[model samples]
Target: MDKFTTLTGVAAPMPLVNIDTDMIIPKQFLKTIKRSGLGKNLFDELRYEADGTEKPEFVLNQPAYRNAEIIIAGDNFGCGSSREHAPWALLDFGVRCVISTSFADIFYNNCFKNGILPIALPQDVVDTLMEDAGRGSNARLTIDLEGMKVVTSDGTEFPFELDPFRRHCLLNGLDDIGLTMEKADSIRGFEEQMATARPWI
Candidate 1:
């Protein structure tokens, strides 16, 4: 996981609602536990045609949004299965942040754990951001996690709410394993004591 203090980059507009986990990476690509290779398959069905050619109509296929670091999507984003691969695919594709009117609970939680910021804003606010993201390569949006603000290219700012603990974790690049490592000394001490007390085992 990487620290996500702040980010400024192109935001691709994906107004489709109910973007499920399977749609994100597709079940065929979920065989591997590794997270790195999924970027190429992110939204595989939508991004490619049956012949495996890039779909020109897809937002991510467009030249301007090919390298987008953020996604502004419609309501009920990430709404299906609880597979963690969805966030992995998004992060691997360089999407550090996602702004939507709403999101599925499991997917939203997974995003934070994977170092992706899933922001849930009001519908009107999301609509504004979606429009802003329509500006092709100029759709640069800035997300300041410490400030809890999303700033548009035109300077409009929208404040969003997030759990304090999640914010802390992301700011310091602490995933579940990283959180456990924070108490490394204590864990090591406990193991040593156990070994000493149970030499026979």
Candidate 2:
């Protein structure tokens, strides 16, 4: 997972509320354990027509938002089934951060595990950011983890809160496996001691 320090990119506006996990990647695309290659299928149902053509009306399908790396989404985003693939798909699609007024708790934590920042701001602030996002690709937003704030293109800033442990994890690129790996020396010592104490067993 990439370390999330400071990210500056175009923010796509998605004001549709209650965007569930199924909407994020759809259940049909959940067969693969691998994280790569899901970007094309992300928002599959919304992004494509029945004939597999791109839907021009979709925010991501629009010319200016085609490469959006940040999303200012509606309330209760990521609110359904606890599919880890939702974050995987978002990450694959280059969306490193999602700002919403609120989020589902499970989905919120999953975002951190996969290196995507899920920001929850007041409705007023999110509304303002969504407007800024619609200002086109040049209105890039900057997320500064070290600074604990989101900066609009014009330098307007909104501070946010995150658990210290999660902040540490994102800053250091430490996933569950990475945290366990850091205890390798202690783990090895414990195994060695166990082996010596019970050779027959």
Candidate 3:
């Protein structure tokens, strides 16, 4: 996991609500447990046609948003199935943050575990950011996690709330495994003590 302190980059506007996990990476691409190679297929159905050609009308297909590092989406973002691949696909596609009015519980947690920040802001605030993101590549949004605020290109700032523990984990680049590793010394000490006490066994 990568430490997420502050991120400044292009933000693509996706106003569609109820964006389920399947729509993110599609079920066909879920055969592999690996997180890499899924970026190319992120939003596959929306990005391509039946012939597998690029869809020009899609927001991600646009030149300006092709390399967007953040996504400002509609309400109920990351709804439906609880597949962890959704966040993996998003992170692999260079999307380090996602801002929306609301998000599904499972997907929101998964985002943090995968080093992607999923922010839930009020609808009005999201609308403003969405408009800001419409400025193509010219506008770049900055998210300061330590400061707990999102700054627009024009200097407007919106504060968001996040769990303190999650913030700590992201700041230190600690995943579940990383958290466990933090207690390695204590674990080893405990094991040694147990061996001495149970020598006969």
lDDT on C-alpha atoms for all candidate structures: 0.93, 0.96, 0.96
Candidate 3 residue runs with Cα over 4 Å from true position: none
Q: Against the hidden reference, what TM-scores do the models get?
A: 0.96, 0.98, 0.98
lDDT of 3 by residue, 84-105 (tens): 9999999999999999999999
- Candidate 1 has its poorest 10 consecutive residues by lDDT at 130-139
Q: For residues 18-44, could you state the per-residue lDDT of candidate 1 as single tens digits?
A: 888889889999899998989999999
> What lDDT does candidate 3 reach at residue 43?
97
Give the least accurate 10-residue stretch of model 3, judged by summed lDDT: 192-201
Put the candidates in TM-score order, highest first.
Answer: 3, 2, 1
Give candidate 2 misplaced runs (Cα > 4 Å): none
lDDT of 1: 0.93
Candidate closer to the true structure by TM-score (higher is better), 1 or 2? 2
lDDT per residue (tens digit) for residues 45-94 in model 2: 99999999999999999999999999999999999999999999999999
Which 10 consecutive residues of model 2 have the lowest summed lDDT? 192-201
